[model samples]
Target: MILIVVGVIMIVTSLVSTVTTNYKKLQLQPTTESPGRDDWHHFSTGSYKLFPTEVNYEAAKNGCRNANARLVTEGIRNKVTRKSIMDEMILPAFNANKLGEGYGVWIGLDDLEVINKWKWIDGIASTNDNTAWAPSEPNNGSERCGMLHKLLKWLINDEYCLVANAYVCEIAKSK
Candidate 1:
C-alpha cells in the first residue's frame, strides 16, 4: 500500500509541473492579434498601419480606433523613424496612387482646441522646433489639422480638418 501511494504522488507531481510550465509559456505569448489590415509594419515604438483611402480627420481617427490603434503621432518624433515610415510606408502608398487625389496624409496633430497651438491626439503639446513643419506652415489659421505634405517633401503641414486625406495608424508597443 505504501509503495502504491508513493508512486501515485510522484505521477501527480510530474503532471502538475508540466501543466504549470505550459501555462507559463502560453502566458508569455502576445495577447493582441494584428488588425485585419495586411500592411501593419513593426517599429521600435509600435506597429503602424497605413490607410491610403481618403477620409476627413474625424473619420480617419474613427478608422484607426476601429483597428485598435490611434493615428501616427509620437513615433514620428524620431527623425530616423520618421524617415523609415516615409520610405517604407508613405512613399509606397503614394507612388502606387493609392492615396487618392490629395497631396497630404493626415497625422494625429491638431490645433482644434486653440489655434496655432498644435497638440497630438493624446493631448501632448508639439513644438515647432521639434516637429518637421514646412516653411510658412501652420500658416493658415483656418487649417487646424496636421498632415505630411507630398509637395513639401513629406514635411509636416497644417491642413483643414475637413479635407479628405490618407492616414497612418499606430498600435503602441505593449507595456
Candidate 2:
C-alpha cells in the first residue's frame, strides 16, 4: 500500500510538471487565435492591430509587412466583418481620440492601378453591392486609396494615397 501511494504521487508530480512546461511553451508561441501583443485583438476572422500613428498609405502597408502582417483588406468582406473590425479594433482608438487628424484608418483597398476600379491589396475586386462605403464616397477620382471614415460612422471612403492616417494591420487566418 505504501509503495502504491508513493508511485501515485510521483506520477501526479510528473504530469503537473509536463502540463506547466507545455503551458509556458504555448504562451511563448505567437498565435493568431489569440492576441499575443497588447495592441492586437483576435476575432473570428483574424488578429488585428491598430497603429494609431499617422503615415502615408505606402508607409502603412510597409509597416504591416514589417510586422509579418498585411493591411486589412480581404479580412473585411462584408458588413458583419467590417462592423467587428470597427467595434473591436478601430472604435476603441477613435473613442479614446488616439487616431490622427484624418480621424480614420487606412485599409488595403485602392484604385491606384485603374481609375474607379477599386481592388484590395491581394488583387480582389471590391464589389459595388458592398454597403460599407459612405454616402457619395469614392467620388473623387484623384482620391484613390480607401479608409474607414470615423465621422461617417466607420464607413469607407476614398482618400488620396499621399494623405497620412492611422492604419490597421491584420494577420489573416489560413484557409
Candidate 2 clashing pairs? none
Q: What is the per-residue lDDT of model 1 for residues 63-123, given as tens digits with 9 covering 90 to 100?
A: 9899889998876766766877898999988888888899778988999998888898877
| 1-175 per-residue lDDT for model 2 (tens digits) | 9999999999999999999999999999976753456667777777788899999999999999988899997567655667788887788778888886875889989988899999888777888775368888978989999998877877889999999999988887852
Residue 127 error, candidate 1, Å: 0.7
Worst ten-residue run, lDDT, model 2?
Answer: 30-39
Candidate 1 wrong stretches, greater than 4 Å: 1-32, 35-38
Give the residue spans of candidate 2 off by over 4 A.
Answer: 1-38
Cα lDDT listed for each candidate: 0.86, 0.83
Quick one: RMSD of model 1?
3.3
Best by TM-score: 1
